[model samples]
Target: MRTGAAATYDPFASYADPREPLFTSTVVSVIGNIGMGKSTCMKCLFVLRPLLLGRRVVVLDKKRQGAEGEYGPIARAMGTQPVRLVPGGGPGASCINLIDPRIGIATSSGAATSEGRPAGQLELVQRVIAEYLGHSLDVLGIEALRVALLAAPGRAAADSREPTLLDLIWCLQHPHDGQVRSLYDDSWTAADVYGWGREAAATLLVLANGELGGVIDGPTSPEVSVDHPAGLTVFDISSLPNSGPALGIVMLLIQTWLSGLLAQRSAARQQTILVVEEGWHVSSSASLGEMFREQAKLSRALGLCLVAGFHHPSDLPHGSPARALMKESSTLFLFGQSEEVEVRETLSIAQLPRELGDLIRSLPQGECVLVKAGADPEHVSIGISDWEAAVTNTDAQLTGDAYG
Candidate 1:
């Protein structure tokens, strides 16, 4: 089994043997409270073995602080502007083709097995519905999406042209059309089918053409593409209206795009990094969480590393995608948390000794407990250069704000 070295040197600075493998796999989970420097620590870790190993980094930056994003400066330092995904429908506003062929999608007959391999097109549509609705789809919704996903692709002239969410919505709303009518089994009438379609896919229809501003309902934007060099590409979705589940949807789409890109580049055998800040968004739902879990499970095979950041232990409870990731993580960083209950719970879930709860609660800024799969867990004060601190600090953008 080929394993990517976790760190070139001892990250805890214990002066241990340089040849010892600190961790295995490429998944790292950073758990901490707000202002505890989770991102800062991750920035330091990202530079260690991943960069030194010639891995490309792609960050799903959800925070929109400036024209760039949370990791904008770092991306710029590597010579690329963050891709701005904004709402309001104007020039400079970006759009993503959610069904882009490069994004992985399995056909109904070719679905991934229970072992968490990539899903087929039908499964991808079902997962998208779950993320969009922030819950599992009912029976009717699942069948509706499945039929649409299966039928629409066959209806398109070019096999390479993937069906859009709008096309699926249309399929649901108009099942009587010759193309989609055959999807209906002996189970229902035209009225029954149409009514179910309205109930099952109405929100998606609205998101595609109504309140969500069709950000995800079209062909690939010639203005925006994911073809970048082997460095960081940050998708800044902060400017989108914050009223709904836009962040989760955007993150899912980004992951899909990256998965497809990696699928195409598999022959290169180059390792890649995928960082999802505010990982709670992806962990909140079963489908989104499972999607992430499957990706982490397949990271080694895909030659990728996933770094997920979360603010609270509760963000990843039992059965959560984040919790599954925690269990499979090769490297773990736990920063300070003021809540005792949270500290204890984190330690318990992570299988650390109960006595460490106090230490976790009392940890100061820039310090954290580092746990590697193959190395002893230890507290490390992360050292950051002045430049790294400037770019990595989340509060740097808020320093000049004042109440009017």
Candidate 2:
């Protein structure tokens, strides 16, 4: 109440000048081995009251769904409902549920018939893959391609998995030619390539006409929580016998939509984040490469934000697309990674200068380093526990229980 001789005026009263620059908004990846809290970070970021966020958000979890309830607590804490859409096809079929009046759940592919398929979708995909193999066909010949396609990974390669189309395609494209000199002679490789190519072609024809599903981007509802909001989507690929067949289609739709959205804004810097988890399946798809290439080059102009989170970059076939994603990325968050090779690969990116490497490696779980491409990088570790409060009261239980 008392003013001294040199009292300073309140900064709030100085309305003429803005205190902060607009954040160059982004959609970035937070990667770690398994339980490093990537999903939790998302919950912390968007699972808030609608009032705080001028816009609503959408989240898609590829591996786990138990944590989904956090959305409810977060939404409720913010005086809003958390709407969750868990499509069918995993251990259970798709079902929609509402966490509260504010949050609604719409599950696509739930009770989806394996019979209904849009004509021409698969035919279009096979043509695309054939064109890609043509690139390697010119470089490595065919034998190496066949061996790569048929060969299995080190048992530790994945958590109880089989040879996926993307894995084979990646091998064909980025052959381990230098690593295995004795496996094939000139003629053997040629025959192998021919056989695998034919098989891939056949699979494409079958798959294109088969029972696969994809997410339709939505913010479709007119009323706030009553309809799909303009934000995020979870195109869960678990239901398919294998993710490889569906990868390209999912990426195609997402990228096409993102590119179109970006193009419409004549002179804006807004970014749409494509949070693609299990991106290995996507990157390996020969048909999806072109879409990714476009996003890496022009996403920001369209104000697009992209975040690719997968078990490891190695699963991504080779390096290029993931490398490109890393280069275009404004921020990268690495969580507790279990694989050493992938950890080293990410460390190479996350830890640039020699001095920063130690600090980066030593950081604990949940916390991550933020590197804004051209600027100096900084490490900020945030700690988070499971948002049980969100889940216990979620529509997820309703859906899961109903399915059970």
Candidate 3:
């Protein structure tokens, strides 16, 4: 076993070492309360350290410090701007196409599999609709959505562009006679098919033309690209309302898009680290949780690492996919938790000794317990330089100083 001071632990070094592999997969979970330096620990250990070793880092920044995202300064320091996503996208706003073919929405039957792109796209759409309706779709609703999505590409051929969310909505609104007959018996008419999809179309209308329109309804903007020269990409979704499904939908879509992008790359390419801050949005939602679980299975093969940060273990419900993913993490960082219940819950999830609960609860800022797979839990104190403190600081507004 690789033994060292917890403060000197380097996940990248440990993962790359073949003789004594500490982690089977590169999934890291950071759990702590707000303002306990969880983000700072992630930035210093996961983001900055990995970048030094030439690994790519992509952060889904949800927390807004003041006028911009908390990761905005870090991105700017790397000579790039956080890709800002706003509601009701207008001129100069970054937009991602929900139906973008680059996302690997399988258009042909040969490409469809239980765990393939077609199923992923189908699940993504269903999840989006469910988020809007506040519940999962019924059998008829799901079938209607599937049929409409399958027919959208063919209907968009006349437009000379890839099918957009609008095209799917159109397919639902106008179910062709031939398509309906092919899917169902002659007894099924276009009106009958449309009636089955009426609720889905209405829900889609909100996404394509209502308050959530323009962001995912149209084609992807020319300037929007995930490939960055600096190897650090931050998708800023702070402007979107936190109460609704918009934020969760965007995060899921980005993950799907990144997965597709990584799938197209050669295996020899450098590994990518995807950091999802305020990850409770993903863990709490059924759709997002299921999607994340699927991705977690493929992450190691795809040369991807998922760094998910949550305020507490309760954010991930018992037996949920997201919680299961947390349990499978190769490395876990437990920072200070003000609540004893939260500390115990976090320790339970980490499979650490419950006797250490009080120690975790009383951990000071910038200090945490590092629990790597196949190793004993060790206390780690993260050291930050003057420059790192300036860039990673999230409390500049309150402290009137750079450090957090």
Candidate 4:
């Protein structure tokens, strides 16, 4: 029903950086281990592409979430410090972050209460909340959320104006209420689904708290603090134990929210750029990978520009799922990768240069091969002249006090 016939839809374009011909969507996988410059490469592209070309941007962070003082400062310098958590302090615990601004979606802990009140049952809340996190989020403003509307595309002045991993997740999870749904009844246009999602998130929060009430009722408990809207939304996971799944879900859901937002913007003749670092962790899941693939299919229509940075191609998953990603990746950036047979196979299937099979062996940190349509993949050296290692920027102002 939604065609990408917006007056401003511009096809993505790029040159000789890749074996593929000229292309639009750029896929750069920075392959390296700890201390290696893998993340640095991702940061460079995150800042470069948009600043140099007036591209609307959204960067996904799952590894550590914020830029620490390092990456956070960089993002702030670029635009808005990525959106971070406010606080999820309720009778029970809400999986939702109070501070997230961009998407305004709430994640729930999941627990059923006779009258929206619970003593403390984290597990039950989480289960109930799971549905909210997995569903809803198409809404931007609603219950359990107190954030503001973010700037329109091309309106950001900072280097990065992104929603924190949490903010974006909440947005994707939040149902839009009766908004787009009224005009378009399809799933893509169903905005009222957001209210149901919030209820789900609230249920989960109560459940999360029920299990960890000991911590919440304690003196050190984090109280509920609402956040103002921000250009960048961040879901700080520094406190959560065993954060992999939580982070993965956050990334996937946020990516989905952005896809839908772009679709709406496309209809309005606007374009935006989105970037994801540590690409494999989120995109590797079969279900999650499929979501990314589906979003990619609409990238051109919504004027959605995307760049995914990862370690090894294998990290993205195997077989058909990984293969599908290759097709979506119009442009590919290959940094030095460990000699994983699977990684090589990924490149082979992606149509990487046969000669690079050996060259890929010697690639170093900061350097990468750019692949796009009509261009022969060429090795690019980002060595010394590149920006400083983009660690998590902790220097940015985080309203920890309000969170308290």
Candidate 5:
């Protein structure tokens, strides 16, 4: 994340003077075991000073405390509350309209086919199906769903009406006249294609009515806004089931939405920052990981920075997009890791000096080694003012109810 007069933001007084630029890396990674100060280190490195300077920020608060998450209180302090999503729906629950044309178009690649229709929409449907279902579809199922979505929005005025998973499910089960038959020759009847569509649609129905139905199925709630001027949008997916597949789907959608916003900001040259906690959920999926890697690669040109934090390097398995992100990150903060194996792996991935491994193993609380890509590492102790320290503490929810 670049900070300076160019960004129209200020640096922390303790770190740099207002006139001097501080923390000018485009991609940052924070790694450590839980309670080893990963969150606190991130807050010190990105949250406190940047927000104070009016740089809009978004965080995926996977810890899910609603108004009580690590960044929720800080976001509210900046004049907005974190948009919270809960299962079974609740007082502050927020639902995203996945079928909104705006969302669909945001993922649109602007690539058109021979028929002059945007090819991106079909790809968008394919991705949503893969992500939400937590698996891949057969070639027939993919084509069937594509045809259904092509009509879901009604080809002529696709965005005129909002299409829900129910609509897709219905289209899949019931052949649309010649549509289903066209997918195959007389060798296979329309019934065969419909069967595949029905199978794929069944999985989607689970996303619409099953555990995460409340959050992803319905008219988009007014609670969440992608364009917040205050510079902070936190999607508290904490309450969503932590099952790896389920979390991966929700996080992918959120990331897609943010990418759309970032794409829009490219012209303004706004320095956009996306901070994700427990990012392993995203990297675990090869598809999502590749998507993230592409986004990070495009960040510099788009004027965006990504800060991803997780408990251990294993969170991003070897050859994962997230691990690639770590390799590309110019700035990194290494908080102490309690486990010996994890520490060694993190150090290996981080390429820190072997001798520092022992120090990292026993590093005191709130102390971390700051390493910039291609530069010597610095063991800097994060020193925040008392009031700042209290506000950034992730444990405020543990000690008392004061955080919310």
Candidate 6:
């Protein structure tokens, strides 16, 4: 973790000329192996340092420790608690509506559509359904879902509330002939539309009433808000199962909501950094990856910076969009990786020379290579205060008599 010389790295420091900037965007990718101090690096450098500068930090914490998320201690130290979301609505649970109109307007080509909802919202809902069904929806199925989404708001108007997944489901189960034919040709009948949408509706029915009930099927919980005065927000989704689409679905919902909320705050000129640990959950999926790619393009304009951490670039398949996204990061922090395949993949993605493979593999804990675009990579060690070391420690549970 030792370098020839020590210099401060500030991503926000500006140059005299606007045309020639130090970095293109604030997007960062931190890659390393498990237990290689990836989280520690992110906590100290991104979370702690950014908070000191009056910047907001939002974490989608997926790593569970004991009964809470790994970032719980950090949140509590900042005078806030992680927004722990539990399934089936318990004593302390948070919910986010899938179709909340507050999601701002989605434009086709710089112009707001007549639907008055973000186009991403429609894609989000469709992606959730596709996740549940284990495949993409067919043409008729996609049209049916679109028609149902368009009708959901009107259906919920009777109850004087915002549209929820339940309302969308109801609309799908009962397709309006006019709406169906309007989307397609006049030959499309209500029964035909109902058949096309029946499977998707049934899939959504299981999602709303099954094990994940109350998580996203109902109205958004008042407790859910991105603008916390303490300048730190953690969505504790650790309770979600790691193997299924549940985690990916919830991540998408949270990310979409964050985009909408941040879009509204564009005038405030507040800079926010969003951290997604175990980022492959978003990048591995084609749908989620596309959504995130679009969001990353807008990160600069929205006054937002995305800090995504992955165990290694090889976690994604070859030619994956995730790899492309990693290459586009303005800054990269690469930690020790023992496996040769992983080492080579990391180097290839970071565009580093193959000769550095031995150096990367031999990096000690709390040490990493800082790679910035248009600059030579620097070997740096992460130095933290005693208090930070105490707060960022993740080995307390394993510190007892066994090792001693």
For all predicted structures, in order, the TM-scores are: 0.69, 0.49, 0.76, 0.55, 0.75, 0.77
* Candidate 3 lDDT, 1-404, residue by residue in tens: 12344356665556777854657867888889898889998887778778778777888787877866788888778777777788888765677888675564434342565422366577778877887888888888788888888889887778788788999999988888988898787977888878889888999888777657878988776434656667787888777775677877786678766765566442456677778786545423456667667777878677778888889677666888767878889889888998877887787888888877877878899888888888778887877988888989888989877432
- Please give, for residues 48-114, the per-residue lDDT of candidate 6 as tens digits: 8889899888888888777777888888788777777776757666677777765433444433457
Quantify all predictions' global Cα lDDT against the true fold: 0.64, 0.41, 0.76, 0.44, 0.66, 0.77
Number of clashing pairs per prediction, in order: 3, 31, 0, 88, 4, 0
Alpha-carbon RMSD of each model = 7.3, 16.2, 4.9, 14.0, 6.1, 4.9
Candidate 2 error regions (>4 Å): 1-27, 46-52, 55-61, 64-209, 213-227, 241-244, 257-271, 278-284, 314-319, 337-340, 383-404
Clashes of 3: 0
- Model 3 CA lDDT for position 302: 74
Q: Candidate 5 on 339-364: residue-level lDDT in tens?
A: 88878787788777688888788878
Clashing pairs in 6: none
Point out the worst 10-residue segment of candidate 1 by lDDT. 1-10
Better of 1 and 5 by lDDT: 5
Pairs that collide, model 5: 1-25, 56-231, 57-231, 64-238
**Runs with alpha carbons beyond 4 Å of true place in candidate 3:** 1-13, 90-92, 106-201, 222-224, 241-244, 279-284, 314-316, 400-404
TM-score of 6: 0.77
lDDT of 4 by residue, 1-404 (tens): 11333211123534223443456464433444343455565555555444446555565554553323234454445544543321233443223322233223222332324323221222222332453355543333232232111211112224354323233234435534444454346654434444434554454345334433232222221221112122233333333333323434444435534643564567677656665555444433445556556666667666765555555555544555545656567656566666667457657656765677656666665555655455556666654332343232222235232110
Best by TM-score: 6
Better of 3 and 4 by TM-score: 3
